[model samples]
Target: MALPQKKQQKSDATAARLSALNLPEGGAWAREARGAAKARVEAMGLPHPRDEYWKYTRPETLVAPQAPKAATFAPYESAVFGDIDRVNLVFVDGVFDPARSDDPAIGGVEIEPLAGVAAKDIHWARDLYGVLEARGQAPVERPLAALNTAYATEGVVIRVTGKAAKPVNLSYLQEALDTDVMIHNLVKVEAGADLTLLENGPAAGRLSKVLEVEVADGGAFHHVRTQGRAHERRAATHIFARLGKESTFKSFTLTVNGALTRNEAVIEFTGDDAVAHVAGACLGDGKDFHHDDTVFITHDAVNCESRQVFKKVLRNGAVGVFQGKILVTPVAQKTDGYQISQSLLLDEDSQFLAKPELEIYADDVACSHGSTSGAIDEEGLFYLRSRGVPKAEATDLMVIAFVAEALEEIEDPVIAADVLSRLEGWLHRRRNG
Candidate 1:
């Protein structure tokens, strides 16, 4: 076995750069939890532009402490799950608002605000806070998440003992301008339990958030999130999950518009016969919009199944990036993994960059990944135009069709329809603008 190496010397320059952000401390947090997370961030300095992981997207804007000036735009009417029935919890500018949110207890699920039990000696979240974030550090570094752990203002912790009667919704209202928000959330689904999480709206003008989840044996966790319509907002978010025997975890995200947004997900399958899937659909239009998705999934047990599907629509000088990977450990025999990332560019100026990787140590594992980028299908566009459809309308329909393939991965019919409506609104605005 390889012995762990000693910590290296920290550069003064790197230390100075990190210090500028005025990272948060563990004032009300558990002492041990706070110390360990702070230590991790101290050891893993911020990623520099020259770093391989940050070469595609610049990190300076994300690491900075100040919320850079951003223009706020009107939100779409009753966006994301407007027609679905669910219990809602609202967070405005990263602070939980009870008056605007729903009750904590719903059916068999119990929800608690992290701020309420933050410094308490006894709490269910003591073991989960920063636990998954630390575990996900291997093979790749997540400095931003570490920073979030070291200093985050607020978030919610949810525990599901039995099947939830209704989906729990997180409605983020970004009403304040130039707001810098950081949050960490924890979720646990006990054995034989089931829960669904719905998230929507722009969290803030500048937001850094993390969610840690544990799905016990036979537990199921489903999540669907649609980022807000604020074209000038900036966000960096992470979702970490661990699955036990026979458990299932599925998450899908639809990103309509943002000035600069980067979302990262890290998932680990620890028990045999577990299943996991993560998918995203992002549409970026106009010069200032940029969207990036970075995902990593690890199979550490036998008979585990995992999948990744991502699609991006870019036009009018918009930029998109997708970095995804799947890894199977030596003992993870008979693992099944699939990954695909595709992009559609409407014009010559739009751009999409992708890096898809699969690393398998087990010989019996089945894994495949592919990436493709191209303009709209000319044949389909011609056929639509031949039907007396306007050229612009025909192009928009083809673009929508391209993204529909990825949207179909969403299982919930109502949530899928909500996403479709948002997509239609975005396409309409893009055409008019």
Candidate 2:
């Protein structure tokens, strides 16, 4: 059978991209996992502008054979989450840096670099490395995630057996402008255990990262991520999570500035009474800035609850996009799902695009979704101005209030405050300029 011209072109581009990279070598299980991921990427090819989901954002820079040059930005403030006490794992140019990292001997948790674990004959990651990613390919194709699984240069595998006293932080630093990073991380929470993961950094000039998390019954997993303030950086990140009965999964992301960013989250509730929440807040400025958040939540068990909340503030022709969906199966009676994506456009030149969907097979389930893009509330702005607040300061204050709802999704109050302060700093700098 003859293939469509566009499809053939995409496949050819995928081949060319794969030929440019040197796949890492590992043990039999690792090899098998990578091989399967490689096949999946080949079959799906790469994303194109014509694709339904890709229509809002262009994938040329991410899929090109050569990475687009990105100059690192020197920020006015220190690193995020620096004040918090955490076990830090540093990565420079996609490779783990032990000298800059704390010892991986945290209590109640086992952490090992993916490179070392992949070389072993048998490990717990063998069952999780690419399993969730493979399963997330249904209803939509994520070729970038498959590519990361096939050629990831570095990452970590974490198994939490009991409640962790402190959080584990993954800090990425980009020392080279042309570095292209591929990282795949795995997290497993055993029954009745809990873990929190913190991620912050400007990974590289170009980055593709995949995180697979599995939570057992009565377990909890919390993740807070901050994409760095690299104005020229480009990144594609995917999170695949499966929650067991009576488990909890919560994730929040704060993106300050980037030339391009696409964040995707696929979550499934496999056990009754499970809870999952995904949220993000982004601030974009300038004509080249672009951000996208795509989330899909599936309710396969009874009495499960899920929520998706995302907010973006754009100005100076920056663009924002959101695509979210909630699915309820016949068995998922008494399910509750809520989704909201809103954008505050500071200028008429900026634009926000959103696609919200809900598909339910259960009559007893309650699912609702809403997307809105508008300017700052005129009454609120006027009230602040009437109180003798400067226009710039009043706008900034309103912006903070607009995004506070999404920030509330953070489970840790201290972490939430830190994020709030960072957002303030970004706005302060912009106002001063």
Candidate 3:
């Protein structure tokens, strides 16, 4: 379905405003890419809250008329990765910064800023640049995706060669700036390749909007994402992955800070033996405000497996939301899919919502989903308190246990320890209060 004529006019206005801005210096190809993107945005109108898929998210608030233009490159402090060894590509204000980045020369991995690649090397981007926008017809229309296409100043592109055994880690840091920033990152993992990607959002700022990702056949991608945006910042990320024959994709997101944050992951299995596992945890207190997690899995091929699990803890007036759906097509015979979402509300004022759905077309396939929301087990709390434990400490112990299920999926012990340590600190503060 196409957008209405009125919405089309609004998109045209957006394009006109975008065209008036001065873009960074680049070759004819970059100019052409930008032009094409602008035209695409013009053709696809803004997505509204009325759209079924976006009913929960209002785009108007994010796409205000006076929204800042695509920000220019600016000097900013770099994120400290400490001793963790990984290929780091930094982008400040949505523009790649090589000076602030550290490129670890790992064998079998090619890491470079997308803008640095030759026109010929970016054939993949040309082919798949707008693939997500085209495939996004479900509830129909994503204004944020359209905005990314229109204003994406720079991006990071990583290509892992076929059958490359080593994993490539990517850290996306958005620095705090006076202006809001939008990033549209396109990642491609080739067939028979394996990659471990770590995507970290801006430490603090009003960095807002969407991010899209794609994975190919025989490709394996593991992602660790952490969001620690400023209290005034509101951010939303949209991750899309396509798995080929015998491919595997795993992802985990940790939301530690943000006034309002929503992270969505969409995965499609197009070939047999494809597998996907997604897990996430949200930690929030009084001022944290809102956190939403959405995961959708589609099995289009036979003999594919998919699993999704999400856990959240909310205290004070903080709110948590989880929505997971699994779809198995008729051709997806012998499909195995499972999903579960559980949340613990620490106070009467706190709120949690869990929604799980299953759509199966094949009778032979096995698909199931479950969701639950409740306060911490009072019986368990009583047992611990009766054993001479402080009530606050006892509550913290239960919350830790609830989140441990998702945290255990982190394979790297050092990374796991870091996450655990952060959790401990958050708990300590809550107990003291």
Candidate 4:
């Protein structure tokens, strides 16, 4: 398959946009990377709904041409973690802000802006940087990832050298600027290192796309990503990670706001004993249409394990989608993989779609997948109402129970409390109305 003629022209235009940037640093490397990416995209063509993998997601809106101007940083406020003091890295319009950011200089951890890092250490940026597109992955056909590679001025890169106890928060704030923006974020974790990463995308505007992360060998990568975009804005993120021997990668995605949004997470267990847990929750209301979650787990080595779970709450005319696939190779004996997707539709007009699959070549492996979609449990609701609970409050309790399972997986108590509180507020707003 190849990109259509019109799509090929768009890729050319995207490459031209990057060539014109003339960045103050790493100009040559950026140009080379963009050119290679354009070629790869051309060869792999744009993915459509007809493609089995992209059946739930149609990529027409993202493939359209986007502006190449730098994102303008604007002042904004965050109600999610209000005034919470922590080591922070601020990106306004996709560019790093040194003054607003902090580096605790912790041991066994290296945190620095991709643009500021020495060229010698940029090898990771060059190797696994555009590897996602080269593989012709479904989300790579997403225009946002292409645009980010073509025009991202700077990125955040954090490498943990050894096992670490503390958690690192990589907060990304996309101030409501007038310009259409794109950000490319690359993260690499070395062998024998354990680290937690918190990624949040808070933006208000016509923001378009972002390519957010990459993880490497013998390393444990934990990610918590939250995105809330205004109706006018369209947001998309692609996360690609590779696991080494005895490594673990855990990710949780929460999508609360967006007019149209899609989040894709791809994990490849390249070595034995690699474990991965991927889960997500999407809360959509009003006419907001969101296709929010996906997980692709591939096992190439023996004794690997992978687990995935996704839950969604839809109201009004909102739509939710969840697609998960787990593949175990013939050599990957003793692979244990499980996947489940469940949804609760709050209204007759609301809809949810889930597709879970498993392909195992190893006969000794244990793999199972299941998907379920239905309305709120009336029995539970009635039981609560019979106990003198108001109708609205009763409904809220049922909804909370539906989403609590996913939230329980959060390992950090502080982060878990914050997420539960937000979930409670969302349930209240929906039930009261």
Using TM-score as the measure, the top candidate is: 2
Residues 1-433, model 4: lDDT tens digits: 3547655554565555445454333545555777665555455544444546566666555544543223323233354543344456776656678777776477667776766542343355676556664442543345445545655556666767875446666566666454455566666678777777766665434444444444455777777666643444566677777778888888887777566677777777778888888888778887756666767778888898888878888888788888788888889999999888888888888888777778788889989888888888999999999999988898878877887777766777777777777777767756667
Candidate 4 residue 154 C-alpha distance from true site, Å: 2.8
Ranking by TM-score: 2, 1, 4, 3
Query: If both were scored by TM-score, which would come out higher, candidate 3 or candidate 4?
Result: 4
Q: Can you list the residue pairs that collide in candidate 1?
A: none
Point out where model 3 deviates above 4 Å: 1-44, 66-81, 118-122, 162-175, 208-213, 386-388
lDDT (10s digit) by residue, model 1, range 296-382 = 999999999998999999989989999999989999999999998999987899989999988889999889888999999999999
Between prediction 1 and prediction 2, the one with superior TM-score is: 2
Higher-lDDT candidate of 2 and 3: 2
Error of 3 at 243 (Å): 0.3
Maximum-lDDT candidate: 2
Alpha-carbon TM-score of each model against the true structure? 0.93, 0.98, 0.84, 0.86
Q: Candidate 4: which stretches are off by over 4 Å?
A: 1-28, 47-51, 66-85, 118-124, 136-147, 204-218
lDDT accuracy of residue 339 in candidate 3: 87
lDDT of 4: 0.67
lDDT of 3 by residue, 1-433 (tens): 4557646656665665556555444445555655665566566555455555555544453555454333222343233234456667666555667787775456656665556642343355655554664465354344456556555556666677754444444455554454566666666777777777776655324454444556667777777766653444566667777788898888887776566677777788888998888888888887456887877788999999998888888888888878788988889999999887888887788887767778888989888777888888899899999999998899988888888878876666776676676677668866767
RMSD of each: 3.7, 1.5, 4.3, 3.9
Model 2 TM-score?
0.98
Error of 4 at 293 (Å): 1.7
Query: How big is the positional error of residue 342 in model 1, measured in Å on the Cα after superposition?
Result: 0.6
